[model samples]
Target: MSIVKNDLADNSLNDPHRLLRNMIDQVPDYLFVKDLDCRFIVANEAVARIHGFESPDDLTGKNDFDLHDASSAARFSQIERQVIRTGVAMIGMEECVVDAASGKERWLSTSKVPLRSANDTVVGLIGISRDISARKRDDFLRDEQTAILEMIVVNSPLHAVLDRLVRLMERQLVGVYGSILLLDDGGTHLKHGAAPALSQEYCGAIDGLPIGPGAGSCGTAAWLGESVIVADIASDPLWKNYRDLASRHGLKSCWSAPVLSHDGIVLGTFALYSARVRHPEPAEINLTQIATRIAAIAIERKHAEDKIRHMAYHDMLTGLPNRSLLTDRLTQAMLQTKRHNPWVSVLFVDLDNFKFVNDSLGHTAGDELLKTVARRMENCIQPTDAAVRMGGDEFVILLTDLPENTDAIAAAMHKIRAAILEPMIIRGREFHITCSIGIATYPQDGTDAETLIANADIAMYKAKEAGRDGFRFFTPELNIKAHERLALHDGIRRGIAQSEFHLLYQPQVELEFGRIFAVEALVRWNHPQLGLINPNEFIPLAEETGLIVPLGEWVLYEACKQNKRWQDAGFEPITMCVNVSARQFHDQNWTSRVMHALGETELDAKCLELELTESLVMRDVNEVIATMEELRKVGVSFAIDDFGTGYSNLSALKSLPVSRLKIDRSFLRNLVEDDDDKTITAAVISLAQKLNMKVIAEGVETHEQLTFLRENHCDEVQGHLFSEAVSSTEIGKLLQNQQSRSGLAPA
Candidate 1:
């Protein structure tokens, strides 16, 4: 037990075995030999020191289980046994181990070979291992970075991504715990984003910590928009407020970096804590900055995604739930409706005279007024109820989990009405507006979202009908009407499919010669079971159900075909007039459909005149004129049906390709009695004559009405006065005898 000056003494040198052992002990890498039982037989100074031994002799006869953990010892024994049994070498095999005393992870590149006896039989193993922890650590960091970015690309939850982030940091710098705290929307407070390595008690205590100059590491870092380092939490002025909490969690130091967005706004903070009171090394500081950059990306991306989602589900102007969100909530509420007291109610609120405001004060002022009304409605409801903007001046208030008591529901409706009744200023003028609300309950009025909304809408119209500024619950009578309407809607589809509809022709008498000049074709539905359904009864229903397009097409084709058949039967050719629905007139393929009908029947375009309501022509004058011009090229002309009943622009009317104007029956009904009706009818006839358009007076039943129209120089007249819309065969017989009896009277 003696030593020389950095060398072995004379007595040690004399023993070659001692000199060789001394040289082997000075090797830096761990070198050892084990017997067949996996017990240490030889060891170097590095191996003994690493295992916390004073000398190599301390490790002799000891095994890995005695110096290291059971798991590490078992792994080592397994590797050695393989070499001993196979007499093969295991070279440069990377493995991990934990320090027995320090509890730190270390990676080693190990090589083991079988130790053979003189007879060349495997007896033991010789082993050597070198530390490769630093290289392996870098590899781990790259792998983790790739994994975290992949999670971000896939839009993983923010909490999950942050949790994995902190765990990755913990793995990179063993024993140093990590956490992330994000700022509130106001950017004045730090809330826990992730802290899986920290105690829940400690995290909860710091959840809503305010950011200031001296409010702990993460708070101060976020407040100052920079990094904050506190080597000793117990004594640092920044940690004074959180010292006790940190002490309870055994945290003595912390380093934090602000997670700033690309615009240099502080979004949150990334922090690392240690049990030992020491400042961070350069590597740890660099890692914190890396974590902050990553946190900024994830936080900003999450916020951006949230903003887009909000915009999708909410109205932009009113900031209320839109129809999409409302529909979802309504469906969910319907599913949750119980047979007990609590009920889900839909309140359809329509602003009274909103169109008047838009017309008087411009659309911009109308929009502002609607926004004010929206706010008032929102203020009238509880948090559980949802206020939705169903577009335009319409709003729907969804009242959920309410009492079944009708009185209570009416009170709520009263409150909403009262709120909207408040006076408001629009376009610099004080104006008062009121809203009409309709109530429909889930599982009572209707179950589905569309049905509930529609029933509520029908009820709202009923309220307006009763008197505006009132509320009404949907009635069973209204439900019956709705069902009948739906049945008729379906029945119309069946009627068309079964060919239960036919056209009737009414002859138009020429006022000059009294001969039948033309015929107006009217469609009548023979419902088979119901016998006959008037065109007025089913025509509007067809329009509402979008079936008017097909029905109108059938009328056009049949009318053209009948005219063609009559002409081929040796009868003089006459113009065939057919009424067109608004939807059919505006159809993109309308011109093509008309041409198809004419081609199918081989009818001359000049003999066909399409009748459009004045309102339909006035809808879009330029477009309507263009369509009429395209058809007018082939001699197909248009007649303004119900001319005086609509608000038509005379300037635009002058440009229409119209061949005639038919005075509405409403004005003609009282023409002989009411002077105003006579004045309107006469004015329309004079105007059509000045415009060089033929004027036709329909619904001329009485002789007095026919006399008034003839006196006004009406060119053509059709109604019961001219054989009350006879069938094709009867009209054909009339066409044969037109000269003998141009007396077009019912008698």
Candidate 2:
């Protein structure tokens, strides 16, 4: 009997049905086997428990249709048929079912596999089902939450975000309607963001409800910075005043949570309303709080980004568009011009002599001047145009869809000039300023932004040179001239190093006596390639290139040395006059330069005269007077050269330590014929005499002009009447002849 029992036990362990049953029972998931007619042929303990049956026998030989709802049974049949036909395994499909014994709705995740014969012909099916009701519910809730969050973030204007959030929660959560109320600046009022759509009229009644203890659900929540719940809106003290509005809207209960920022500052409150008296679930309250916090972040970020963009494009000082934004607009305009072949103009304007005004007046006045100019420029441009502050005293005007004929550009330039010249009152003083404008047109001047800007800069410099308070159009000739000037500047620097320079002396003859009284020292350049270059050509070049400072010093030393030689050679003490440029005269070290030159040459300070133009005297009268007085005390004299040509002030001249007034060549050129010239010359001579100053007439070409000057009491005359400027060797011979005529032999 024992041997027989052992054989039976071996058979039971190796039998396929017994082995399958044991494996199925060991799995955590519910496992079952069904026949072709869909009856459960075998069932594990898990499967029996899943169906709310007492044991495996309870579920055996029963179809899923007998155990579940028709829909659940139909879906399971479809999956089983698919798996059988394909002889494959199906995985993780979810379905809803009603428990047979418990009569409760439940969720299950199921997988099915075909049980095939040895020849691979399907005969039955094996399936696994899991109790996934908790997981499925959690997933559905997560998707709902995510969708609500997305709606809030995407909708704008903080209020809209709150409105969307309320709608989402009302649809998802049972027995829940909601409202959002934002706090005011003083935290004393509640501004409604959203309310239940059905109760919108009631929400409107309390749209701007005041915030305090017991005012309403939202107000109490905001005041306490915590949840405020009125389980029964009709009876709660918190909703005492709002109960009528709430009852009219059919709201029975209310719960409010403070909407706080990440830093815990209350921004608003979220309130839930129930159709019947009820308390909010913990999950419902938590979800509402999450939505409120997210709304705060979105609103704060939007405001911050808007503030940053404003600061980026606007000029802090004048509240105008700055260079960065202007450049971007200009680039877009240029691109449009290229694509459409339209005419566009860029006007680069620079305030003329603005530095002088800023230095003379205080910074406050300078700032006021800039603001006034900005306003005037803004008024001058059309609506289609943009006036931008390119920084400092520079501004740019962008004109689009302009006329191609260039007349519009000219008119624009005229407007700019007129606007800038309008007098402005700054610090109780009337001030006038002007601008130099450079106009560069698209397609004509350049094809790109950088090239256009460069051409405009060149044109601006040309306008300034032609004289400020005007504008110039970009031209090829102007660009070439700019390059040539640059080359000349470099060449002048080289000229000084190479010592390619010399001096000539023009005799200053006494007009009444017809004898040389003084000699005007003139500079001459003898270029190795271009010989004997005239002063008119290189002297202005030197000044513009700023080479005049060193060149002027050389001339002063040479002139002083020549005067000392003449004095040593028995000639009468004659004043040696050297023309000083305005730049050199205004230099801080000018007085020291003069003293050094006199000391080095051992020339009598009385015999050295520095000649300055009328413009220099009028620039700063007080400073000029001070400078002249200091030099006069050292025995050095001053002369007003090219008189009656600039803005000459007689009072300034009288106060200046001047010994001679040289009439400009314009007045002396036609003194013998032109009545205007003769009158000007005679008047200048009379004026100089009244001030006890000598009068020297320049540019005397003929004996008739010299005779006129002699009769007019002109003290000195310098021109071809005596001799043109000559070399030093020629000057020595002339001095010898003068000494012989005076019966004074050379030492």
Candidate 3:
């Protein structure tokens, strides 16, 4: 289209300039012409609308600088100057432009072409621009959404992403500021997640906002798990508590959407606040929903990550740090030693007799006891110290910055003991549990966590060996003993497998008839290198290492075999007794094993007896009774060994299918010297007679002790007074002598 001469004055239909103006006015792309001096000569309707002009004529005589910001105007001038000077067109130049009509930031894709006179000289510039502001805004929002997605995927801190999200939301919607509120851990309260545009005081006032009905926009949204739009906060009942606070912060209209996980559980809320009182438009509501979904993803992902982290570092049962976390913390503590030179003490604790609780009261009560003890242990230490359950009845305390003197360590150990021994009532029964603790200090007990923990464990064993209910510090001697104990444990394991364990039978004589009644088989380990190791030295260790189960089975089989050998050798078929450890008795299949042993040896079940300690029998009496009944059905008898030394439940004992009760040797050792021993011996005999069970006094060594037991009507005696625990051959000779003395001949 071209402008004709005298077109401004022409009234005819063939006015070229008027025709060009009419054509350009219908085009949506902005069209304008500028003279050599950069003055706007003509513009189309699109350009006029953008420039806030009523008509194309209103832009006439205006330069780019007059309509655009200085930077944009300068760039436009340079481009137009180049087009006018060089007759070159600049095409599709993207630029940030200030919209003259609304004074808003806009993006435009602009092209400038030179205008030529009839003489072929560059006269002015003609520019066509397409407003691309909406595309630019959409791209910006897309980037923001991408960033949010990255934050969720990479496990970035949730708050940082939410803060970025609210900022993006505020910038996207004019006259709207945004906030995000997250549900607290308990899911009963809302905490301020991010509110950059809102005042800190306003955020503080709304933080810890309870999630319930009528709890303002975000709180109510979270509580209801739905969107809540308040046209006017001043009048909305939901904002009654927060209206004044919002008014002070110049917030009026509020719209909120619950941030919900895919499972429909509310995680948080996304909200927008307007200074003006008005309902949210459809577009604003849609934005709120989009923001809420993003917020939900971030919140849920963070919660899941946190839960996983907690599970990794924490014990599920006691909620204390697990081995993994303990190792990590101990490593860190060791690292800190070089800089601060502080003492780091590791206390290894083993709960004494904890198995009794599990056996007697059930594991449920045992668990309660452990958790309660864990709490008490935590209370005994400083807040900076850590107490952790190192799995089942074993705990460790990491103490930092302790004194050089041993007093503090001793005091802490004492505190731990006292705390554990404090009477705990569980399942309607009171219990006093004891713990053996060992202490290992940094720099002295080795420099690393593993060494320190190992040493502490070594000391713990020392404490237990010292009779338990105590604590011991790691010493040089303990290290040697620890190594020896380890060797012993290995030896015991090998002995059981290699059949290195042998039995020593002590004949139990019928006091009235002077005939052999039974022989108790005592296990003796003939270690190839260590020689004959007494049961006292290794029996407890076997129990601790869970070696007792297999070892006990070996003893049972060996005792049954030896008894069968005696019977085959034409000796009396007296009952052969085997001692059972608590660990062996607690084995669910113990009765079956005994039957198997008897079956394998082909020994008469009537000639076999299983001896259990008072404590072991009292633990889970019902289970003991059931086991005893099963054995009794096969004619196997039961004996309560170490009778008065353990906490025996007399009532439960009455229900046991026991054939004999053996008085503990400790009572008999002082039988003549102590009146208490004499009285206990007499009382046991009387009780056994009343229950139709024979009483046997063990460890009898002198005439006075044997006379006391006989006068007390003890049905049998098994001690040095007759013979010590001797070899099978020695016992065979003694059995022969006893049978001969009783006027019987051994084939």
Candidate 4:
């Protein structure tokens, strides 16, 4: 648009309006003036050109409706009227106006002022506007991109984040298509990272592309540790082999950038694809680099999360399910079974003598064996079943969806037992491991995860008690028996601590004289809760718990003191016999403890006899022989108690430094009725004689039993046939009576 030269010269020299007009023409911003009728009165070259007019003379008389569409004209008129009536300036108003020159909507930052006449009345509005479309568009895109990235970081997982990133880049670039490829763990190949817009068949074809020179844009980018832009896939040697694959997917060009870690190590490649043959602009290349950086962040985060989760749920040694995951899976299995009414068996398996392996071999070997067991157990169960390592040699298998029957559960357990029994070579030695399995089924043994697992563990102990290399099913009776055994163990421990034990003496009479020569000290538990508990009930429990060591010491001291007291009272000096448990016999301080008891009581060692069961003596024969010799040197005699019950060899028997053998009560009770017992008892007597040991027959309840013992030349007899085991006072009376009856011999 042109300004009048005379008016401009006049304004430039003297008029302030002429100077203002020249200044407005020098500015690039669109400048205009409108009348009260909303018609353009004055316009600069920039405003006239934007309205498709050659000069201001062509645009001056046009109204807002002449330059813009009707809707745009109405909006402009409304704002102009408000400015004119209020006589206030409207500043920095933003509007979307259709450019009359291009017919394209452009965002503008505009200002309007109410022009007043000399009478101080509003005459029209003067406007100043600038095209801000590019700035506004750029700002909007940046905010949108920042929001998308924030959402990805906060909510999306690794792969999903990568997928969203690629999709967003594609949308931002309009027609550009892209994909993300990650380096495999081995760093040898490119794997499908994310390509949401790509077809599955195309992704599959390019998924495992090797990372090397001439291996396509992504592969080459990863191989070279830089960006690779293939202007034409069909012609570029990098895509020589992959050209046909790319062509088939309608991709003609590809640009790839290596995704790098913070240390600049190549993590993967990000690529943009195009259907038309072309090279990427600098902006597109930068976009790919940014996408690659984001992909690396997402992938590294995912890997870290996976590693933590894996460690949480998996056994570090065996790579089997740990207790935490096992419990979770078991709970799920139980829930499923409850809904479907199918049997879900929880099998608690403990490798028998696993400690022996760890003790004999090192824990390294033990770990190898456990890993092998995990693999074997895995092989035994179905894919759906979970094999869990419940820590150290204890494993549980959750067998799901089995038929509701014992047979099905038994079959599964059989497979597991067989699998574990298979021989393994550890530390160059062939070894075999046996496992005890306990099966607890859903809705039968228990209903919940904890109950089922606990019951299964309880049954496993039962299997161990029955003997290892076996399996047991959980039953209500087994549960009762388990609780009873636990209570008995506790009771035995309490009884020892509280000194609830008292000794009763069963006289070992001289068979020929019919006189009480010696007495066997038998322990009885004076339970405050259950009166007079038998030795059989708690003795084994005491041995198992190692309480027998202290209990045996108490018995020894009590018996020796009682014998010394009788001697002090001017009664007959009698030898005292005290029973020693297997655990007590194995105590390294056993001989010392025995001597200490004798010393405290001031009883002669010759008058103290320690009776050990043959089974106990037979175990570690050399050790037992040494122990016997130690006691024998101190003038303490040894007797193999319940001699015939155990399978101690006769040769081993001869080596023991013993003075007597007590026939077990079983043989004595059935001596006349059972010929087997008769033969065994007779053989025991003969064996004792050959070994230079005296024989004592216990439980001689009848005359026939005593007659059999007497005829067999048994040295001592102790049973109800003479008198039952009696308290200390009762035994004193019996000793006195026996002394009086010593004048008469047996008929």
Candidate 5:
């Protein structure tokens, strides 16, 4: 190339061919200049080389129609006409063309500009073209990848992430079709997720493919936890057996990569199949590895979520539904009952005296006992009914479709009681426990969850108050009594401050002599407005409201003081019997309370007898015996109050240290006429005599009952036949008169 002086001085303008030729040679893009008749006038070296020509001369003076197929020529003409008609440059026109001389297809991205003379007449066309085959192929790959990504994301719920990676490699690498085979639940089989598009029939045929060393490509990959390649499916042992099926579906080769969890547990395999025998490209292998990692994360996350949800609703201690889930179920059940107007019952159960067992036997034993109780409760209810543990020692049952009447509920309660009371052997020790049940019915007790629970709780407490190991229904009367108990609690507190309580004496006399043998000390509460209240009304109220401890102390102090006064007034010492409630009897300070009362009043312990009901003695015989022995050491005699009315075993009675058994007044009410009553009394008297224990016939109001008691040789008697429970002042007067008449009073 030679440079001229004019060209150097005015580089902007020069000979047209020289300027065009220089621009074409300097540009990296391929450029060509064509005349109006479509003959190539000039061509850049890059354009010549792009068409596999050795020199520009070979490309110049040649039209696209001479070098291209009709389809390519038509596309070129369309671009040239567009530029000439608009007199504008056509930018970035992409087309695929087959080189006429080389017979090879190449993609060209071309831009054409209209060439004109100085007078503004169209002279020719100038074109710029780039060999973009690589870019075009990459773009095609990206579009295919995007479509496959969407398909996997939408279809492969189990292996979407891994399936997409496999599909991407299959599209980007030639001669490859993809498959994702996940391990089945048994861990011995491979199940297809997304299979090769070309081998659909083959994949379907081996959908539930087995896994082993040489079962198949996917099976071998999963078994070895590595990649497996069958370069020729017909010859490789891994697919030797499946060669017929593969040949039928036009599959000749397969490659597989093991899909594994983060911990290296084989989850499945990612496989690719080829219609013609071939090896996997490096890009395909790389994508398979990436997909395996993603699959591991997704599968692990799903499994973790499921495990957590399972644990949240179950109790770890007993494998039962915990309080949270159980309550939710109960609320739903209540809603169903309300909507359907069906019968439903909620049972509130509390173990009877569980605290004692826990305290005496340590918490380990207590825990074991609770587990045992949970199992028994689960057995007691129907499958439709739910037995829920509301934490320690408390259980609630939601029962539906109960019988029309409350009898079924009662029967269920009894069954529950029986189940719980069955003896349990824990830590080589046989233990027996019972439960107190409170039942609240739908619509009758409450319609809502909270109201039903509250009513059930109230009824449960009522069961405890009525002496435990029993069941009670929620009733209006119980609610009234609960309110009255609250009122009495407040009243007792006020009474203690105002000194409104007093003691009365009920005379216990010998039926033969009409002489007083002992005096039963009873408590009286003067309510100021209500005049006087009997002990029966306030005593139980005091016990329930936990006011008995203080009230009982007051009674002991007042009774001992009264007894000492009568003795100081020269009347003979008479045994004063005081009723002890179960609550008071269970108090650890009871023995101390009695000793303090005796010391404070200077009264003899021999003259004081503590009366307890039959049920209290049967609760824990050994503990009761220990308590009785402690009291006996201080000269306090014992008596069983209202005997023959409870579940008292004859063997247990023989072992107790009680001095006398009081026949319940009901038996004596018609003792002379009713054969059953007479027989009961006779048996009691005979048993007492045989055991050398004294028998007291209480509530004897008539002389006929008195005569019958005398004939039966009953040891002592106390009732209306002698006198009613009277005030202390009247009791003192009667004692003085009796002492004077017997000539045993001071002169």
Candidate 6:
């Protein structure tokens, strides 16, 4: 509102001078009257105290330039002159001005009215201002926190968010610089998070300060998990170690608070440094607290998200890239191969007999062994290469930047095998392990991720079959085999479903009497298109594709049914032997399966014998024996087939509850000349008899071999000597012939 002509003379109160002065001084707001020269003609107590004066008389005749810094005083004089010259009243103008008391910026809601004389001529301005510094500071902090939290929720760049935070903190405190120092990944030293106000040289000097008691304010705060306030860096004992550095940077006072996560984890530190040596005010402390809380939220959220992604893409046991990561990297490598590296190799590395270790040493030690192997594989590869764990004991190493030479690839594969073969010390015992690696290269072993991995897997199995520890590259022939294997697997599945599979019985003759007392039921798949498919091809494929569980069940039930039929037909009673695959043997429900077949066929468990290979028995001897004992209790007997092959030491034989042992055909095929084979056969028979288990000989095709078996006192024999495999009706005829020759009854 404009001043009126009688505005200064309207009051008629008694003792007006002292009354008006006391009233103005007690208002708790700054009030003053300025002359045409912008000098203070009258001042109140609030105005005096704000300008660093004890009494209003001290500022009575002083100008704005005398009470404030030149910049602030000039701004004030310009605003007040407009009110005086235009005779206009400016209302509610918020402006920043220097506080002469603290030498810091303060905010004011100021209003100025032009004063007029009795003639209505403008004279000077009357100023009234209310201190709004605290309110403005709170509003600024609220707005900034909201903005930073929004950024954090949206997953903004961490450095950018923290930079804005540091600058916001610096804005509230005069001459105070702000920094946020993040703890390094190792949690040992500090790394720069944000330091927008600090000099580059100073920031670099303290970037990696290890957190400790006397390692400056930020470092000590981080180490102690508490706020550290060094009021005077030049003389404080906490800053004694860093005093020289502080002096070089003109930093005199510092306050630092540890930034802690919600779980009390130390994420970093928030620090405020002042150029002048002084204690921090309440406002400074409040900003430090708010800034640290916000920083903790930002850092902890980042760390939590990062940890989530890590767990998703990495194997839990070995901390290596899992299959998903393997596929991703393979795709990226394939895309980059033509532009960058001459070749990209995907090595399918599988540990040999990992299940044996896992069962023998317990899963705990097995996990330790896997972790050790993973580390060795990592060390064997370059930084550009990735070592991924593809579940269980399988791994894949992706190699980039390879020379197109076969020799170099061979060298790399050999190095990896050598590293893997080194003894790993786990849980206070040293153990040896080996890996079979299959190499599939870019532009040669198929182009896509799935095909390359598949080819490499095929090559790996081939290497395992070649020997225990070896490396082999994928060949075109291997792909053919792989495709054929896939076809056979599918065919066998369809064969079982469509009744294309039937049984052929090979008679196992009692050696001393020459009577057919038992027959081994072998499976034959008769495809409608390709004639009879070989068991030699499909058996292994069925096992590989996990179709053995169903196929073996069918074989078992069919064999028992055939044996029951023969007995029902008034033939001599005989044992029916069924070959069990390694996969089926390891199944948890395998015992139940055998019992179910016996019950369904109404066959005597006594006449049914399950034949397991020596390798399957040795895979996990304790578990195998436990299962064998369970079956043997129900009157079903077990036998070790292929006794001379695969883990054929005498140590595992004596404890097994086996009723018979079968010599593998490989030993019998060359027993006429190979002394080693003869010795092994004789030893196996002797070992079997000593364990009170009757032994049988397979592949005995000649009378000489028969004589050899008789010399060894073998209990039974089965081969082409009597017959190959025949049909059920032919088996019936063979059984009748045996009975006629021996003149035996159906007993």
**Clashes per prediction?**
0, 0, 0, 0, 1, 0
Model 1 per-residue lDDT tens digits across residues 1-747? 445633545547767888778878988788999999888989898888778778889888988788777887898888888898888999999988875546677788999999989999888999999989999988988898888888888999999999998998888886799999999999899999999989999999999999999999999999899899999999999999889999999999999999999999999999999999999988888788878888898899899988878877888788999887999999888777753447889999999999999899886898899889889988989887899998778899999888776776787899888888888987689888988888998878887997898799889989999999888899878877678777788899999899999988889888777778789999999987888998889999898656999999999999999999999998889899999988898776899999999999999999999999999999778888899999999999889999898878898888788999999999988888899999988999899889989999888889899778777899988888667888999988987886466545443
Global lDDT of each candidate? 0.88, 0.80, 0.87, 0.84, 0.80, 0.87
Clashing pairs in 3: none
Q: Write the per-residue lDDT of candidate 3 for residues 503-601, one digit (tens) a residue.
A: 898878778876787889998898999888888999999987778999999989989999999889887789998999987986757888998999999
What TM-score quantifies how close candidate 2 is to the native fold? Answer: 0.42
RMSD to true structure for each model, in Å: 16.6, 25.8, 20.6, 24.4, 26.8, 20.3
Residue by residue across 492-601, what tens digits does model 2's lDDT show? 67777788877889888764455666788988777777677777877897885458998999899989998898788777788899999977886668899999999999
lDDT for residue 83 in candidate 2, whole number 0-100: 81
Name the regions of candidate 6 deviating beyond 4 angstroms.
1-14, 30-129, 236-241, 327-342, 357-365, 418-434, 447-451, 464-470, 480-747
lDDT of 3 at 592: 88
With a 3 Å backbone cut-off (N, CA, C), the pairs that clash in candidate 4 are none
Greater-lDDT candidate between 3 and 5: 3
Over all chains combined, what TM-score does candidate 1 have? 0.58
Candidate 6 residue lDDT tens string, 257-316: 999999888899999999998889998898889899999999998897888778778987
Best by TM-score: 1
Order of quality (TM-score):
1, 3, 4, 6, 2, 5
Model 4 lDDT tens row, 647-735: 88778888888999999998877788899998888888888898788999888788888878878888888888777788989878876
lDDT of 3 at 115: 89
Tell me the RMSD of model 2 versus the true structure: 25.8
TM-score of each predicted structure versus truth: 0.58, 0.42, 0.56, 0.53, 0.42, 0.53
- Name the runs in model 2 displaced over 4 angstroms: 1-457, 461-478, 568-571, 743-747
Between 2 and 4, whose TM-score is larger?
4
Off by over 4 Å in 1: 1-27, 33-42, 61-75, 81-87, 114-126, 153-156, 327-344, 352-367, 400-434, 442-444, 447-450, 464-472, 484-747
